[model samples]
Target: MWIGSAAVCLDDKNRILMIQGKDLVEWAVPSGGLQENESLEDCCIREVKEETGYDVQIIKNLFIKEGQAEGGIHYQTHYFEVKLIGGDANINDPDGLNI
Candidate 1:
């Protein structure tokens, strides 16, 4: 099983900050798998910044989803509301796929 976190960042105009995911190429909230020893709050902030180049402050957990895959792999995702702090939107990452 794997645990992941996502950030739902809202802008001043009430627009949600969605990224063009590298793998899925779909517009979705910034999210990623949690790193070892990393807190969920830190994961949310880091994932958002890595994907959208926007630093965020997680406000609260919004929801949790759990499920299983065909290969018996289980997954859990935690979603949180976040506020943008700083950073410029950059959809380019040389070492990995980017939005």
Candidate 2:
């Protein structure tokens, strides 16, 4: 099962949160694949922190996207709108992601 999440985080000023794509070299929202032994909510929180260093609270789910790839790998992604609870915003890629 392929499961992942992406967060559409906005600030009080209505500015959207974005990150430079580590692979694609374009601006994109923060997202990541789910890890073992963690809830989906936890994955979202962790991914945001790992990629952008911002702590967040998942307000609610926005949508769910499911599809199949070329090799017939079924993939699912959960999108969420989040609020900033704390933490600074900056790049802190744990996996050394670079464009």
Candidate 3:
């Protein structure tokens, strides 16, 4: 099973913050798989910072989606509403994927 977390942030204009990695054709919220010994919320916050260069605080958990994909891979993703705390809007992904 693959476990992940996603961060949802909205600006004052109600525009959702989205990111597109170099390998992804579609835009998506800042998200990533959970790392060892890390909480889901931490994963969400870290992913947002890594992908978008934004520090955020979790406001609330929006929802969780769990399902099985083709080839029998099961996945669960937790979605959370977050508020920006600091950092500028820029790509600082250590993996060099986000653009």
User: Which candidate tops lDDT?
Assistant: 3
lDDT of 3 by residue, 10-87 (tens): 989999999876877899888999999999999999999988888999999999999998999999999999999999
Off by over 4 Å in 2: none
- For every model shown, what is its TM-score relative to the native structure? 0.86, 0.85, 0.90
For model 2, residues 1-99, the per-residue Cα lDDT tens digits are: 699999998777989988886457578788889999988888999999988889999999999989997889999989999998989867776777762
lDDT: worst 10-residue window of model 2 = 90-99
Model 2 TM-score, all chains together = 0.85
Q: What is the lDDT of residue 58 in candidate 2?
A: 96
Clashing pairs in 3: none
* Residue-level error in angstroms, candidate 3, position 56: 0.2
Model 2, position 91: C-alpha lDDT score: 73
Q: What global local distance difference test value does model 3 have?
A: 0.92
lDDT of 2: 0.86
Write down the TM-score for model 3.
0.90
